[model samples]
Target: ARRRLYPKPFPGIPYNKVSANRIAGDLPELIPVIKATNEYSTSMFAISTQRLRLPLAQDPREIEDILVRRGREFDRAPMSIKTLKNFFPYSFMGKYNTPEVKEQKRIWADAFGADFLRKVAAPSIYNATLDLADGRPFEVVEDLHNATLDAIWVALVGEEAGITRHEIKKFLQSQRDASDGGRRDPGPPPRGYLLRREVDYVSEMIAKNSSSGIPVLAQKLAAYLPRHRQFRRTVDTEIGLVMRKAVDRFQRLELGRLEAGENDTCMMDLVLRRKVLEAKKLGRPLMDPTKDKVLLDDTFLMMFASYPTAQTELRAALKVAFPHPTTPSVDELLGADIPYLDAACEESLRLAGVAKGNLRQTVVDTHIMGHFVPKGAEIFMNYHVDHAPYPVDEEKRSASSQAAGAKLAAREGISRGDVSRDLGSFEPRRWLVKDEKTGQEVFDAYALPQLAFGGGYRGCSGRKLAVMEFRTVVALLVLNLEFLELPEEMKTLKASETIFRLPDMPFASLRAL
Candidate 1:
């Protein structure tokens, strides 16, 4: 049994010999530790201990095989989102592979489908960017989040809803309350804060109940923790408000459409109308519209995931956007001829590494990459590890060749040292190149195209909407704004790792066009 369960750890110190925490605190480069200990191992490894097994599908082929080919054989780690239930006793995030989840996913996918999203959001996004032409330096993250919040909320949530009018302060404050065990004061949130419902909704869900032991079990026990008590209040209050507002607006829209014989669809209206139909057939009173569970829950899930991922990608794009050589004008960027801008978006997501990986579970005992993974074991499908760019071919990087080049340069009166381009650097041009002969646009696909958005059947449902929003918003901002490099002092910004990689407190500023 021990042999079957452990399958020999991937050549690392025994769990008892060294601690994961100590290694994190004491070691500056844990990647070196991984390289040394798990040197040649691939696919799966216990790394530290039998109880701490981590399956790494590092190769793109293996990633495709697992996440795409054999995706059904696995499920997202069951406990990965169990903590979400504290907010909605039945958060669809905590449940998976059910008919309800499927139904909700279908609805969400349709609502965020490319056509539906663009029709609703294109004009607003264009106008939002144009609004930023004041030339004063403003916080880019804050502005982006606010604009993203409004765009999504108005399009998906309600026609009248706007980000500035939403209780943005409450959500941000609530998130702080939830994560820190209510250690911070439960102070009153400011009114009319920007980035309201969308921000708070996701933030509260993000707060993990404190624990040091096995994460799955620790999270399971997190809700009963005292800190969650305060956080729950924030969640309950906001859920009530969002649900009330969504339902109220949905009814009015449906009534108007029916009366005027018009065919219009807002996101929530579809779900509500479906519920009403189900109720009429089943002889029940539309069964607590919000209690359909998946409808509201899934909206929250998509919004929660969508907004932050958009923020990360947008912020990353801002870092590379122009007041410089790579800049394009509004017409040029929007004209569909800008391959470099498109490549820049892709590269930004890859480098941001926002979602490092997903945690999946082996549904039954299975064999992968020659390792025996038993039923219920966890698999860490790491995007960061699998998305690595390969080292430069040594033959092309020979020391003799480099020395000769240096000598040639010296003789030419430009004594520059051998320039080694870091393959791992953020090079947007990796995605495209100008054709040498015809100068036509051509794709120079990354050697290993980044799967920052997980690749598989369970690929992001919100991806279409996210793409549209990111492309439109980032491009508009880039066309008009400039992101200044941070001062050395401000550069001290630390990243707070979560399900997403978030800047702890980024102070990036943007100037108007």
Candidate 2:
């Protein structure tokens, strides 16, 4: 059995090794492992000490076959839930499997329905992109990240949170610290600190205005303050308080709008409606603003989750994918197909696997791929490992070759495989195909790839919104300015494993066309 599983000594090197007693860690670069696992099963691997597991699938079909068809059989693997607990203690309130989580998911999912998504999200994204590209050589990651944050905030909250690069950087630092059990140097001040400060600033403004009997004037003044130092105190305290107040204010505003028959189509408004409708459907009383902090938590959590991931991914994508000197301009990208951009974003996500590894604790003794997985065993699926290369049909190979050729041509004097192999390697076009006879297009023609949002009944509820945001950001970047690689000396940016793969530092430089 050992010989069968360890046949021929796996050739690909492991990405990260920590004393032989632990699970061998794989990095994004180890695509071959993912490819091999997708193609064949090997029981020699043990994800945890007590249970031996099989190789993962690389193609989407196999992923779907397992996740979709037999989803109940497999469960979400355990991951570091500590960070989530610390940051969002109130929502799931640190409980992973709770009624609150289910309720929050249901409310958020309902709020992001199709019509609300297209109208509110799409235009907001377009405008935000244009605003970011208003004649600046801004770092693509920073700019793109801010754009996504602003767009999501506007869509969901009917207001912008005034996101800034420094604030985002600090927020990311806090999340990273939380993930490592608060171990690493406590990098930069906690972002919660900054949010608390902002809340104080707004509250003071509101208080001052209230005394003057002019609430509107105070709001206008607070809105005008710069994002940085807008609040004079810590972010957590200040922002938390303000959000509490805003939730109340928005609820009342929504009521007035409804009374007046106003169709204010924003995320906050949509969620407010859903909450009421759901309350009625379940035969429960309407959400009490004062008691049930669920709505407030849901509103803020959505903003928080949506912002950092989008920012981190956007930055990582630009840092790795853009060619130096003469990258594809943002304007050129905007005109491209939404699906193609979506594919690029998906490819980036697969390569990065932002959430890193997912963990599951066994509920009952079960066998997976001929290996015994004992009850209570902890299992992990390294998403990065599941994204390796596998057998590709003629069409896929051709598309990959074309994308490679295009990169080579763009480099002009550089060696064929230098930049092409290390960074800027993935080609979105590799995922597309055109019919030879009629020249019609085919979407995801390759066998099912391991790129679904996730698996099971718990699959991503906000997939539609996420796709729209990704497509909009990519298109805007492609259209506004070309994505160029920074000079060789400045090209050593690394992905920091925070809540997502954020740049270790601001991406070197992005030149505007």
Candidate 3:
């Protein structure tokens, strides 16, 4: 009767037999794993009776099948949608492949288009990075995070956020105020420095939200906790700031006060301008920015999601690319021929491993890595472990995937196993290939199994924008400054995950080139 009353693992799949007997199933075992890794790292352990689990996919070929080819078999996990919807209701992050999501994507499609990225986003990112070349031994992670915030803010609102600039000004002031003529490295700025209250609040809330796997329950319980209550209040205040910026852009469009060229408008102006055009075409009234929940929600989501990944990956890229601080001009760094820099960035992205994996739900009963997944079962494509040197159980993979894997293995520079031994190290040359037409080596994205930005329709929509921002920041910094070698105590690679994976020790001792 208990077997029927409580959930149990599907028949013929691997599971903890002892967990099946308990009402909590895998909760007892799962907590420890989450505590250690900030993620579910129980590869192939399907002990979660709440849902049939395929913990992590060790094979990249099968990952491609699940994310791309077999879309009918797997899709965005329902639990993921449920959890994220509370925070990002109108954003694509929380939605399935429906008409609404398609429309949302279409409306904002040009935001990341090549022309917009080059003319609008790139300049904004370049301007933001200008404040960082002061040659102080600043906290690399925090400063970069602020720089990203500034860049994204300018892209979204068509004005300077001055976040990084403000921090720099404060840092300079702090140094000047010191009795010893500011010669000492005072380390990263104190918490709540100037406009960082909102940033800290967002981080605190996300960390608290993810700490308990059950976000919805945790959200409800948050109302009673004093710290959480403050976080909610601050987040709400931040939302007001975002909404007001939208309102300002909307009013400017309505009043024909666009100071920049039509093509150079901020992301908010682009959306509002399109909306105005659409309303005029349909003979409807102009939509209010305050009333359009989709507009407000997606803008908020973009601000929160854009920065952390680039900052983390940039740290990894810098560590790999510039060991002795040889500088290049900005033109050389951003030119088409910098294959080494490009390769280093790709390698760092692979090593950063911000997300543990992406979750997918089975649309119908299907096979993954030769195991039977029941309809509605959830599976995690464990890119984090797959990028590592985990042994692939080839016999367990489906025949079609096996054929695909075999075909990839036959090609030189295609198979991941070719460089399996060096997977853990930072080697950029692995991603470089001699271009037959140009007779010059170039970074080949396909050289490695690419899952950093994810794949298919449900993949990260802002990937292009993120990459552009990352490359621009990395190039500017690498060209203009020399990142000095850190002391042993400051070289720790420990990271903490919340909204995104972030380095715990993100300092960069530097000198002006």
The TM-scores, one per candidate, come to 0.67, 0.59, 0.82
Each model's backbone clash number: 2, 47, 1
Q: Model 2, 290-333: lDDT tens per residue?
A: 34555555555565556434333444444444435343443434
In model 1, pairs of residues that clash are 168-196, 171-200
Question: Candidate 1 residues 397-418, lDDT tens each?
Answer: 3243345435444442122222
**Candidate 2 regions off by >4 Å?**
1-66, 77-83, 90-100, 164-262, 277-287, 308-339, 385-424, 445-448, 489-493, 504-511
lDDT of candidate 1?
Answer: 0.52
Judging by TM-score, tell me the better candidate of 1 and 2: 1
Can you write out model 3's per-residue Cα lDDT over 202-256, one digit (the tens) per residue? 5566566655656667755654678655644554455556556655545445324
* Candidate 3 to truth, TM: 0.82
lDDT of 2 at 342: 55
The global C-alpha lDDT for each of the candidates, from Candidate 1 onward, is: 0.52, 0.47, 0.65
